[model samples]
Target chain A: MSETPTLESLQAALDAQQAIFEMHQSMNMEVFYWWCTAIMFLIHAGFLAYEMGASRSKNALAAGIKNILALVVIIPTFYLFGWWIYNAFPGGFIPAEASAALPWSQSMGPDAKDLGTGVFWAAFALFGATTGSILSGAVIERIRVSAFLILTIVLGSGVWILGGAWGWHPDGWLLTKLGYHDVGASGVVHAIAGFFTLGVLLNLGARKGKFIDGVAQTISPHSLPMTLIGLMLIIVGFFGFLGGCIIFNGGDTGWTTIYGNPTNLSAFAFNTLMGFSGGIIGCYVATRDPFWTMSGGLVGIISVAAGLDLYDPGLAFIIATCMGVAAVYFAKLLENLGIDDAVGAVAVHGFTGVVAVILVGVFAAGTPNVNGLPPISFMGQLTSAGVMIALGFLPGYGLSLLLKKLNMLRVPEKCEELGIDEVEILAKPYPEAGVPAIAASDVPNKLANTELQGA
Target chain B: MGTSITTWENVSAYFTFADNPMALGLFVAGATVIVVGLIRSIIKHENEAFKQHK
Candidate 1:
């Protein structure tokens, strides 16, 4: 005769089975995270296209290649150390116990048991790549490839990630000590990238023929269609970016209280559209130019992106409109200061990010932190924004100045005169398929033949 | 843990069909082809850039 199992033993067995099932479910969700990550990667393609289109025909290939190379350098560097920096240095500003988030951590690699680290790391890497790319546009026509590459590593894998650790991370000192909140990286990504571009611009100086008798001259884009396509891609990628940040895996609650529930997809969608519309209209009214108008949409979203999850749609629209109008003036101000930003990146990303952070204080006032800290306040937000600007600008400017002193920041004047395309790039973006090749010696003969034919 | 085919069989049943083996193989082949095509295009672009410089 067999003895029946006790009730306590059966309950224990059931608990063990439940735990195993939950682990499997978590792993499945992690697989979906990778798929979402791939979608977000499309943003880089958009950035590449948009930046290339905005550059002059002579500089298009150089600009495109530069942005692409930034990604190449940034990805490996980020994988090796950047993600760990974010996790480890969150308490750097305030003296909290340091946590080890080394690359060799078990959660970082493929494991059937733990599942969140890889995708989370990837998401931050994409942010780093974007930070590097935004600076590409500002110094396009003149920056030395080597200098820019160095800057890319510092800003992309170094500075921006540091900002994330300080402000955007849950355990970041800015958050823990100052009650800092940057939901979608207005301060961490856009502000830092913009400021870094400004720092480099101060040392690299303006492009050849950019200024005339102390006045800035406008340089038109090579292709408008390509620029438009790039902008649209960025808009689409941003949706996934903002959405991905909200992911958490606790219990029966789907996308709930563990992470702050400031807003949902619908809220973001509504605010994004309104902000874009308002920005475009405002920019058009200010500049009466299609280029600035399109840029207005971008500036608008960036301005409100920090607080989109918290702001009402109407507030987002108003704030975006104000930011767009302000950006045009700021771009003009930078130009007058002899800082030539080819794509207005400083105004669009840097200035607008600061503004967005400040606006969050107003809109999110009295809102409780996810961790039950004090409500969002204007002073707290201002202090956080100031820290972001200082951290990004001071180090970047110092590094760039040092690079300039080493004579490595800008290309030779001869290369600038001949165009970086024919000099250093050594490749023509467009190869003539039908045109006959004529050597310098043969040019006279060809001209004579054409003249004789005309006679 | 039980060294049983119960879980394995249940999972396989979802994918099992009379023509599934061939169809799955063909699908994998198609994906590979598409990926190869994209790689070819990227390589062509780079080659053209190199040729222009030369």
Candidate 2:
């Protein structure tokens, strides 16, 4: 026997349903951002494996350890000042509204009232750390761990965060005054990291025996399987990285970019996939090499990233393919100049990133910015690119030069030839299986004996 | 009873926060752990240099 609902009863029922709906929506938003942050972990894992495999057998352990340490050190520094800087300097050099992000701020901690802030901050922190890892691979085999950690902190938690504030934030000067638009941080993250690595590489110089008599020599990776697998993980992680770029509004009301413009995840999905395929195909066609073909995929995504929110999938694909071709050729140009990139990060991330941001200006001309600002323009995007180069390159080159002068940058020439792993790690990655007198137990004693002999 | 125009208050309400002592304590604890761990790592890495010169 159902009662016919009076007006009051109907109203009560509606209120209950609305409350439940609100709760569900709140939880879903938190879950979405958490998932994005979790997925971004693969980016670091990929970097670890990718760097290890790229390094020669003698320096593999050293290459891998520095990456882990970078993550360890950058997390705390980022919390201390990096998050604050993002909110503080969005207006450019002025610490406007930085209180909300201070380390002592209640909102920055684990609180029942806020479920979203920590996850969001974690995602951005991952972005900063990714910038540090990019420089890590280029200067591997020669760099001391302590010196590398110092540079990592500067780039990861300091310089890169500053770039993000000026370019990616909603109130950023680049967005407000210049009408700059970069949906996927091609300039802020990728370009800054890529060029910063170039700056450091300039100071670090080529590895020993790399360019004898002014002729370049190719140093091959120890394991292609590991490198390829690592890259695939990075591709998977990128899905999460791009997801963080869009803010989720409650329910089906849709999402917005950091710039407060309306966008949809469907558009991002289409462009990312098409761009990735185009890059691989383009690289395969140009170099016909496996490494370049795979790296082309990364270049392709970066190439199309700035325009991802607005591009037709076909257009995204075309742009990515062209960038892929350019990345391989540009890498060759750097090599000819005797710049040993070790993994072609400069061409893949830096050059393609700059080109992509500029392309967005040409392609997305007249697209309206938020708050009734003028449309996105060529000069705005170009100016942002120029700023990123200055922020990324100058400190990288200058500070690394300073480290070199202090004798804290590179290992001694003898140490470089003997392998960073043996010199620092005190262990080998792969021990010979069939050495009668050389046992695992003898390693420490052997190390001690050698040390005593040297002394 | 009200117009549908969005104001600064409405927009600011979209950002979430929790101003409580428990949350503050959690931030301090997390930070302390990271700092301690970093110090330990630096000590260990530096100590290894005594074993080999090349």
CAPRI grade, predicted model 1: incorrect
DockQ each candidate and list the results: 0.03, 0.15
Residue-wise C-alpha lDDT for candidate 1, range A1-455, written one tens digit per residue? 98798999899999999988888778766765676567667778878888888878777888888888888777767766688778777777443433334443434444433467778788788888889988888888788776787788789888998888888777777777766767768898899898888888898899888899999998888887888788778777776666665555546645522125545567667777888887887788889987788888888888888777777888888888888899999999999998899889999899999888888888787777866665678888898888888878887799889979987677777667666666566656654533555523311233555756877
DockQ of 2: 0.15
Q: How accurate locally is residue A342 in candidate 1, as Cα lDDT from 0 to 100?
A: 88
Interface RMSD of each: 11.4, 5.7
Regions more than 4 Å wrong, model 2: A1-13, A433-442, A445-455, B1-51
Local error of candidate 1 at residue A185 (angstroms): 0.9
lDDT by residue (tens digit), candidate 2, A1-455: 99999999999999999989977887888899889988988988998888999888888898999999888778888888889999899887778977878877756765545667788789889898888888898888888887788888889988888989988887788888888888998899999999888888998889998898988898888877778887778888888889988888876667988887899899899999999999998888889988788888888898988989999899999998888888889998999999999888998888998998999988998899878865799988888888888888998999899988987788778778888887777667775734654555434555555756877
Best by TM-score: 2
Query: In model 2, what are the clashing residue pairs, if there are any?
Result: none
For candidate 1, list the clashing residue pairs, or say none. Answer: none
Let me know the TM-score candidate 2 reaches against the reference structure: 0.88
Which candidate's DockQ is highest? 2
